[model samples]
Structure formats: structure tokens, C-alpha cells
Target: MKKLTLPATVPVKELAERLSVSGPELIKYLMGNGVMASLNQSVDFDTAALAADHFGFEAESEEAVAEAAPASTRRRHPLLDQSRADPKSLVARPPVVTVLGHVDHGKTSLLDAIRETAVASGEAGGITQKIGAYQVEKSGRKITFIDTPGHEAFTAMRARGADVTDIAVLVVAADDGVMPQTEEAIQHVRSAEVPIIVALNKIDKDGANPDRILQQLADRGLVSSDYGGDVTVVRTSAKTGEGVTDLLDMILLTADAEVEPKADPKVGAVGTVIESHRDPGRGPVATVLVQNGTLRVGDYIVAGQVYGRIRALLDERGERMQQAAPSTPAVVTGLSGVAEAGDVFQVMANERSARSLAEERGFAAKQQQAQPVRRITLADLASQVAEGSVKSLNVIVKAEANGSLEALRGQIEKIEDPNVKVVIVASGVGPVGEADVNLAAVTDSIVIGFNVRPDDRAKAAADTQGVDVRYYDVIYQIADDIAKAIKGLYEPTFVDVFQGRAEVRQVFTVDGRPAIAGSHVIDGRIPRNSICTVLRDGKQIARSRVAVLKRFKDDVREVARGYDCGITLEDFGDFAVGDVLEAYTVEQQNL
Candidate 1:
């Protein structure tokens, strides 16, 4: 047999094209071995190796594969090549900070007060919905603020092993004290191991008590700086803008307390995506904070599973820019797709090589996806527990009704342990189908059906595929079974709640009863039936439902890619243009 030559870099879609298959088919191949990927996703050498094996080919080392390719195809970006310069050679960079707290805590207001911008007036519910990063110069020093979702999105990012935060601005309403979200913010900040700057907001409220807020902070081990503690507590009212400058000054001082990392402008680029979205005009756009190297126009870049040559670069203010360096957040255009938020982005070499490598990777991915996935059995579970291969017990749950499905999924996530993750893949109110079975089979995951039964074909398929399909009527048994399986992994489940945020784009009047709005699909996919808050300008105008979806008026379901579509809201009618809509979903884990 002739030896097959595999390229080091492969574009996933191209590989699918080469095989005359779809991207999802290739994804299924890799997923068969517990590796989850989307059609546009890129796979590395190891993943490609696995794919090659499944395709009956000899796997080559990534380095070896790269050498076999043309030199032009293996070129490296200048920015990435200089990632390790001395700290003294680095330029002063802005401190990336996250503003977090409970609802109505004036988190957005404080940011508005700092930026001197009217962002607060554009958000829904008066709470910051998306993770926005912007820089402001205070007393000749630059400070970057990352407005994280006050809800579950922050936790979701952490759950993905990507902690894209530096400092945390914990905004606690003086009257509200330490509310649920406040504590959650504290936990998230602590989990990221970042420094905290407590902003006692809403002090202008009649019930405001900064002293009580400080006491609450002390209870949470966040002692104030005035009281001889490391954490800085600034009292500021977003309404009156009182003590806001002092807060900025303190932020600069705190930033000075930390050592800065050096940036090698001559080396390869390394950065983090503060935010990313697919714009109709610009394609894949990412607001990237160049951390270690300089980024320039025409640079080929790899961000998460996507790669493309930079077509244009714009600053946070929407101004065109030629280059951006450490700590500067620039919106870069031209990517294979919108990279996931919090994904690390690296500048690559030429576009041809980038595309080639991307294609090879895609081919390898397809091979892996076509392979049969191993199912998780009791024996395999025991071994996985012993070997810690099962850090989380994943489940694809389906139920007879929406309400029961939601409740059961929620309850299952509440099982609590830090080591196990209870993931509900595709949950709907319907009979368990082949799609569910296929997902479970490929993920080595379990299928839990509540008051719902799989069809004979699905059951037979599950059996033939060696998948475990567990039926449950009682919610507790379902929870218990998952809990036991997690225990078998020896790592207790940690029920950490995660939040995701999306922006509303355009609103359409559905039958004139309630309005369905088009939203810029932000951070995560807008799960069907998740509660949504609609904001006109910056204030939350109403709460609504994603009643029905018509993609380009075709009457289909589920919209991604920040695409504009006609959607019907349940029992609501007030929607306007330029109003931000935030849809959030909460995820619970066992810990």
C-alpha cells in the first residue's frame, strides 16, 4: 500500500470536502473517541493522528508532518516567535479587569462612570449582559475593564478551563449587601485567583450603607484596604458618580502592585479574545487583547478551532489600526469563523499555509469522527474512576415534557462535586430518538429519559452501539444514578452554576400578539425556551420568549452565527431597534 502523506495543518472543512462529506460527519468521527468538535473546528496533530488511525493510515508526528509540507506552508508568524522576551523590554499594559456583582448592584453604572460613556443606557435590566473589554486612561495610566455577565456566563467560561480575566471589580449594592450574584461573583473571582477591587455601588440609594457592605465583605474574607487589608474597597454611587475617580486611582495603584509580563513584539502573537462575533459586514470579528506579542494586519492567526488571515484591524473605538500590542484590545477582522470567547489567539504565517494546514486538520478530524465511539459501561466507569479518565459524567437527557426536562436537568446539575460535570447535551420534550442515541454513543455518555421512552429502532440502535440508556420516572433516581456514577470516578461533583449572555439585534412583530426579535448570537447558543430579558436602549424593557424561529423566513428552529431572523416572543409586544436583549442560561454541576 502506498504511504499516505498527511499535512501538519488541516482545515476541517476542507478535509470534509476532500472526503466528500459534511463537517458534522467528520465531527462525528472524532467525537466517536470522546473528542467533541464542530464542523468548523480545527484539530491538532494528536487529534489528527487518531483520525488517521481510524482511516487505516500510519500516523505521523506533528513535527514530522510539518517538515514534509512546503516551507511556505510551515511559516510562523513574527509575533508568536517573540513571546519570550525579557520583562524589562515589555511595554506598560492595561490591567484587564472584570466588573462583577449582583443584579441592580450598579456594576454597569460604575463602568459607565469610569468610561464616561453611555453604555449603561444600552443594556437590558440595567445589568451588564456580555463580557465587554474597554480601556480608559486615568491620570496618564491605562486601565482595561472586562464587564462580565453578572449571571452564569462567567462560570461557564471558567468551566471551559479558560479563565480570561485579570482583576475583578466586585460591585456590591450597599443596600443589597452580599446577594446571591454577589457571592457568586466573589466565588468566580476567587476561582480565577485574580485580585479584587470592591466597588460599593448604589450608595446614593436611601437604604445604602457602605459600612454594612464592608462588614459583609469582611465576612467573605475580603477585608478593605483602609482596614489594613490587601483588597481595595471603593465607595462610589453610580447615580451621583461620587468617589469614582478615587476608585480609578485605586485601580491604577493596585495594578502597579502587580508585575507586568513582557511583550516580544518581534515574536509570535499570543492574545485572548475579549469578545468575538460574526458581523454581517465584517464576517468573523474578534476584540483581542494582545498579551505577549504585537498583532498586525494581514497576519494569519489561529484562534481556537478557526484560522484565517487578518483582513483588517480596528480599535475598540472602531478606528482602523495597523498594529496592536500587549494590553491593547483591537477588533480584528477576517477569520474562518468567530472564535469562541476566551479562546487564546495566535498569529500564524501566510494565508495559503494557514489554509492548507487547516485542511489537513479537517481531514484528520473526519476520520476520527467516522470511527465507532466507545460507550461508557459500568466496568469502564469503574476503571475510568480509578484512572481519573472520567473527570465528569456527561449525560444526554430527554424527557416527555419541557417542564419535566428542565426540572430534571436542573436537579441533576445540583448534585455537587468539583470533579464531576453533569452535562445535559440535547434536552427536549419528546421521545428519545436516534439523534440522542448517537450523541450518547459518540460521547461515551449516558442517555437519561424521563417519562419518555425510546422507539424500538432507537433502543435497538442503542443496544447494538453498546450504549447505556437509563429510564427514570423519579427525578431523584436519575440524580442518584448520576451521582453514583460520578462517585465511581472518585471525584465528587461540584455544582457550579454558569451563565451565558447574548445580545438582541432586530425585533419582528409576530402575529402582532408578541414580538420576536433578532439577536446577535453572542457567547453561547441561545438554548430553546431559555428565559430572556429584552432591553431597549440600556434599560430592560420586558421579559419574553423565543416562541418561534424563521431563519430567512423559512420557519426553521435554532439560530446561531449572530444572524438576523424573525422570531416570535411569548406574550409580549414591546421591542425596538438598537435595543439590547440578553438571554442567559444557568448550568449547575455537582460539587
Candidate 2:
């Protein structure tokens, strides 16, 4: 059978030509299959596929074709987009790796086994609370590992900047196999275009089958080297340390050859703040991963608008250190204020220079704050497309729970627009805040809050930074708004106004087509030409416009409370006694 590839939506005539069939023949085929479409009209992927099946051809969409390609042929991931350092001053540095996988897939357990620490007990729910960076010595060579929260919501923070991970160590359970978060992590790692090493964890568990897990990985396009693919798969038991040593060996081997994680240590210190917070005793503290050069005590550094001299540097063990080399994580205490989690920290020549640069940045921030918030509207999307300023709509979503956030993210991801990609930058459980607004402003993203409200400070920051913060109580509304905005397909938004209701007293047929619902206006008033809804036992069953209204054989425009009226529902005849006839008007508003 012939194979045909089509877009998400294809015009009828275009599809006909591709199938070597006439437009009328295609339309007839659709009609035979209970689908109606004109030659110039469009049909969705499902419709096209159905018609193609009838025509003896296998159909696939462009997205499906792209997704079917080997993982090695995929484009470099956006998270791994790090600029190279000066080769003249470059020295071999430990490869910074990140462990990402599905929740409860033993990501933390694997880390604990590697670090030989009990950090999991400190977390609230056995899940990693925040991003943690650690360096381990293997065979006298160091390897930096960034332990990201395995939950799906934390994926947003991983996409902020590149050079974050030189290699991604995907942890998959030997029995449980690849999951939703695993797919999410794969998308991120692919965007970074970094080498991957699979840790088939939980080999000690009952029913564990490493081969089955490898097959699942292969289905996801990650073929292992044991099967002739370049990707390495290491079977490991985080509890028993079985194959754990080999995993480390593979990491070091991959880093030495495939990743070559090196930086210029002789230059000024430049690194990213993996996490930051306020310490009651120390005032402020930032956990930073030095990507280039060296971070030392007494060196004045500027991060965002916060600037200060590094008074002390502490390693992952909380011990004071004098300096942190490239790929090393350090807890620095000396920032003037709390910096952002993803902010880049760079050492300046002196405290004076640092302060000067910070003042300038602070002024710029104030100016941004003075501007009006940038709302994502259809007109804005049109302008952006016209100017070629954007090809994707980057969004950060915050919700009240992980389930809601995940559901919202899934729906948002499915809003297909061939012109613009909908990129959910990050999603987590919480009210929207200043941190969200700050990230949105820097990345030209919008903040979407589901069943959550932003605090006063977050609102103020959003207003100042001109960041768009939209909140929604309904999940479908969020999807609808984004679809309209990105596709330039705005419809009249309707607000239902309660114009009173009538309880059905009896039902009479009119010409066996229209049903007359004899009802009494129990409250308020029921006006003519209003949209009517049939409520059966407090549940709405159908909605239609009021076609006819009468009071004792006199045509009336409305019936007030305590009065009886005869109402004929338009295109609806199903009426039962004890049913309610609700009348309301649709209030349309502009987008």
C-alpha cells in the first residue's frame, strides 16, 4: 500500500491531488463515510486518514513523520545551547551531568547511592525539592552531577539556559519502563543535543527485566550500544550498588570522549545560580555552579541587580572553601540580596564596578516596571508573526497542585498551530510569584496561573516588568484562549446572564416537530428571543433559542414571575414534566 504524509489539516482539493483522485471523488468518499467537506474546505488529520484508508493508502501526519525519526537525527536541544569558552585558556573540566526521569523512578535513590548520603529523608515527600549540584571523584577524576527534581513541573527550570548539562543520565526503572515525565525529560535532553547515558535502575526489584526496559527505550528512539546504538545502557540497583560502579565508569568515559566538558579557568568567574535563598544568619546565600573560570572569596560578583563580594565559599558538604573551580558547585554567602535561581553570576574587577553595573541594571528594571504589562492577544501574535520576531509562544504555568498542572500542561501542549510552537517553559504547584514574572520577562514568556493567585509582590513585579500574567479557573478556557491567540481565530466570547427560569408543567407537540413546554415563570422573568436551556433535575440536557412564547393565545414578548406561559423550543422537542426551562442572554465581548 502507498504511504501518504499530510499536514495537521489539509485542504480537500490538495488532498485529492496527492491521492491521484478527483476532488468530487474524494468528496464523495467523505460523504460515503459520513463526512461533509467542500473541495476548498479543510479536513483534519483523522478525517483525512479515514478517507485515505478507504482509498487503500496508509496515512501519516507531518508531526508523526518527524517524531518517527531516529533520536540521533533530532535537532540540538535548546537547553544545551552553551557558547564555547576560549580554547587558548581552556582546561579539561569535569562534565556536568543531570539525572532526569519519571517520578518514583529512583532518581534520588540513584543519587543517594552515588553520593552515599541521606538527602532523601530531608525532603518532604521523598521527592527532590530543589535543584542540587554535586561533584564526585571517580578514579581520581571528578564528575559534576546536577540532580533536578524528577517531577514533571520542574522541567521548566531546566530549559532556561544552555551549557547546563554536558550529558544527561536518564534513569529508567527496569520494570516500570518509560513514563510521562521520562518523555518530557527526553524532549528537554534532545533540545540540548547532549549525549545521553541510560541508567536502567531498580534491577534488584522483583519482576525487573532490563531487556524489556531497553526495548521500551528503543521504541522511544534511544537505542542502546548493546544493540549496536551509540547510547550506553547500564543496569543498576541503587540499593545494592550493583552495576553502580560501572555506571560511573561509563559516565567518565562518555565525558572524556563524547562531551569534552572544559572551560577557561584563567578568566573571570562566570556561572549560573542553580538555587538561591535568604539565610537568617548570613542574610543571603546562593548555590552556584561555576561553568567557566574560578569563583573565589573576596571577588566582587554581580548577578541580576544583586552585587556583593564573596565573603565565603562552601562546598556541597557545607564546609568553607577558598575557591571553586569550573564545573564545581559552591554555596556563596555575600550577595547584597537574593538573586534569581537562573541568574548568571559573573565576577567583576572590583566592588565599585559591581555596584555600578548593578545600579544600571536596577534602573533598567525600574523602567521596565513602569511600562504596561504585555498581554498575549491575537493582535500581538499577528504583529509578532509579521515582524518575524517569534516562532513560538513560551509560557510558564503555575497551579495549585501537580495533577492540575500536569493536566493543564498536557492540554496546552496539544494546541497545534503549524505557525507557532507552544512551549511550556515550566510548570509547578503554587501561586504565581515574582520568580515566575522575572523568568517570563527575561525569556519573553507569559505566565499562566491555574486555580492560583499571584501574591502582591508578584503582581507588582509583573506590572513593573511588563510581564503577562493570566489566571483561569477553567482548564478548557485556557486552551481556547491560547488556540485563538496563536491561530488568529477569535470567536465571540459569551457570558450567560440568568434571566429567570420556568418549571415545565406539561409538554405538547406542535406539528410533530416543535414541542410546546407549558411552564410557569417561577422567578424573575423569562423574556422572548432569549436562549433557553432544558434543565432536568438540575442537570442541563439541551440548549436552544426560544422560538415561540404565548400567554393564553396572545403572543407575548415575556412572562413575569407568578405567570404561566407556553414556550416552544427551537429545534428541540424533548420536554418532560418537572424539567426547568432556563432563559438567558449571551453577552458577547471583544477579545
lDDT of each: 0.65, 0.76
Model 1 CA deviation exceeding 4 Å by range = 1-91, 117-131, 159-161, 226-228, 259-261, 360-591
Compared with the true structure, model 2 gives a TM-score of 0.55
- The digit string of per-residue lDDT tens for model 2 on 43-103 reads 9999999888887666877787658754332222221212322356667988888898887
What ranges in model 2 sit over 4 Å off?
Answer: 1-85, 117-131, 151-154, 158-163, 227-230, 375-591
Writing each residue's lDDT as its tens digit, candidate 1 over 275-378 gives 78888987888877777668888888776667888888775556678887777777888899877776666665556545654565556657866775544554
lDDT for 22 in candidate 2 is 48
| Backbone atom clashes (below 3 Å) for every candidate | 57, 8
Highest lDDT against the true fold, candidate = 2
Worst 10 residues of 1 by lDDT: 73-82
**RMSD, each candidate, Å?**
20.1, 19.7
- How much lDDT does candidate 2 score? 0.76
